[model samples]
Target: MASYYLWRSKFGGLSVPEAKRLKELETENGRLKKLLAEQVLENEVIKEALRKKW
Candidate 1:
């Protein structure tokens, strides 16, 4: 995609280690986001179930 190319160009000057670190951080960020989303969904389900009980 054009946006991807544009982003790559912006980071083209990064050293190999910098690029590797960036990738690691991105992966961790994605994992944390997924975990947060799952927790939110579970909370919503629990709330709904409690509402029905009362």
Candidate 2:
């Protein structure tokens, strides 16, 4: 337990609310990254379709 707290504080001594906010931010970041990846894939598909001689 002591070692755990020591490691936790070494990384970040965030309080309860701060830790909660950090978790929320991390979740939001992950969601946004996934959305951006999907959008980029869609754009690439569109570009490929447009490039084909029709």
Candidate 3:
């Protein structure tokens, strides 16, 4: 969000260190989102399977 950019600017005006950290955080966020999405998909599949039997 906007707060993130403001914090980054205070550190070093988006210098190499800030950029590297940002990239690392972004990658972590992406991995987490993917994991969450996969879980949701699995839940949906399980629900559908149960619905079919019931």
Q: What are the lDDT scores of the predictions, listed in order?
A: 0.94, 0.88, 0.89
| Deviation of model 1 at 15, angstroms | 0.5
For each candidate, what TM-score against the reference? 0.82, 0.78, 0.70
Q: Is candidate 1 or 2 superior in TM-score?
A: 1
Task: Tell how far residue 50 is off in model 3, in angstroms.
Answer: 0.6
Query: In candidate 3, which residue pairs clash?
Result: none
TM-score of 2: 0.78
- What digit string (tens of lDDT, one per residue) describes model 1 on residues 1-54? 999899789678899899889989999999999999999999999999999999
**Candidate 2 structure quality by residue, lDDT tens digits, 1-54:** 999888697547788888888889989999999999999999999999989946
In model 3, where do residues sit more than 4 Å from their true spots? 1-12
Tell me, what's the RMSD of every candidate?
2.4, 3.2, 4.7
